[model samples]
Target: MSVELWAQPAMMSDPAPEQMMEHILKRVGDIPPLPVVATKILSMVNDPDLEVDDLVSVIQKDQGLTAKILRVSNSAFFGLCRTITTVKEAVVTLGLNNIRNQVIALCARSMLETRAEGYALEAGGLWEHSLGTAFCAERLSSTLGLKGTADQVFVGGLLHDIGKSILSYYVATRFQPILRLVDGEGLTFVEAETQELGFDHAEIGARVALRWNLPEALVDMIAHHHGPSRESKNRTQVCIVHVADAIASMLGLGLGVGGLENRIDDEAIAHLGVDDQVVQDVMVHMSSIGDLRAHIGIN
Candidate 1:
């Protein structure tokens, strides 16, 4: 968790998986806090009786956030008939759910929009990948008649790989061996990580979400996004994000060092009642969305 752990070569010198996981959990304390506004917005969104006025009051506290909301609301992308001049107006025009997605996106941008050398991601690469997955999950939810949970799924997609950020530091130190395993052994990045470091990013990410006190569903999505975890009860949401992550990778939105070394869970697809036709339709829809970065306000 601290630099001291990494200071002693003996500590990492062929440690077992349990030791590696212990180290990861200790480091969770060092993971940065979610932006205050993001935390507030997430709490509001989780509340069943949330009101636009409540969200407006929370957003109003941050002038910069309020401005961003207004700007996006008035942007041509939204195609609003009239200009939005106030937080309340923006909320009304964009709807509380849409605003919630934007808030999560904006808040996550700072943390996710950076290069992760271990993953061979350039600056902003992970952010693009996360955003693409988020959009894909949202679209998939809508297409499958699970619209009620679309927003939650979007957040899950955005955060599915969050553990990668934390693992990057350790990965940087072991990058060469991990890459060797991935390239020469034909192992996926997560597999390489598990082989070389004892734990994978998914497990680390789930712990990070738990440490941040995020929702249980989001935690499951992050933890089991590569596949379904044994403890996952929200199978629909998990499968949605799992398929979404695969779709994003297929699109080459943010491939990182892992490239396309991933598999789409056919069972996950079937679980969501998505057939090949639906997959093709989703691909077409994603292709037509043109400039996903702009649509999601990633720039």
Candidate 2:
């Protein structure tokens, strides 16, 4: 089938709902902006030459983020033996990257919790799905020994389908035909999107991440989370996200026209040398991921 690629286009004037969806999603203005403090923390974390104190300074600047990090460190999740009250203490105890990741996750809550009309997905549903994907990515990374920080993997998984947020707003009203195509014709979400909307969420999301000044690795992960074969510096991360997304959607953690043909990313699996045993283990571990969904911050 000859298909016009869902390749992202430059932002333009108001157009059809499909184009508007692309414009709104590809441009950062449509989605909630990451907090300035969080942005700074991400910037420093992404820098290889950044000093430890620089990261501490950025964390200290956001009093709320600092407090949240400290609280989570002390929480049962980390199982820290001692209490951590200061930014330096938290950083030293939790690792700078870990703390930065925690802050980013916390900060994302506010931005992702708003209602989006275009996709018919509620605030809690999207966040739940994102969180689930993050958890799965971390687990999968450990299983695969992928060369990247777990926190980075978590962030990649969480933000992978952020374009869907834009889709919900711009294309939801016009997306029925896309869903119909998926159901009646058995097309995947990307294929159905292209058939009906002229673009897919992955393309729009990649552009969104780029506009946000997110790390290049992260932008690619989000862009190709659905299409791991697409160009990406971290193909393992892309595959992790793809599997994690498939797992979450299959378990029905969040709503996004679930039951779409779950793409397995066989090429990436073979490239990464992941054997059947690892896949089995992931399946066993995540078998109950859905039941645990309510335990997360999702409403």
lDDT values for all models? 0.81, 0.68
Note the residue pairs that clash in candidate 1. Answer: none
Best by TM-score: 1
Q: Estimate each model's TM-score.
A: 0.88, 0.80
> Could you give candidate 1's per-residue lDDT for residues 1-299 as a string of tens digits?
32223322334676677887787778555546787788777666557688888988999999898898888888878777888999899878778888888888887776677667678887788888898899999899998999877887899999998877777777878899988998899888888888998788888889878878888889999989998654578888999999889889999988987759767877886678888777777788899988876786445
By lDDT, the best candidate is: 1
lDDT of 1: 0.81
TM-score, candidate 2, is 0.80
* Stretches of candidate 1 exceeding 4 Å from the true structure: 1-31, 46-48, 79-82
Q: Which parts of model 2 are misplaced by more than 4 Å?
A: 1-27, 44-52, 76-82, 116-120, 147-149, 286-299
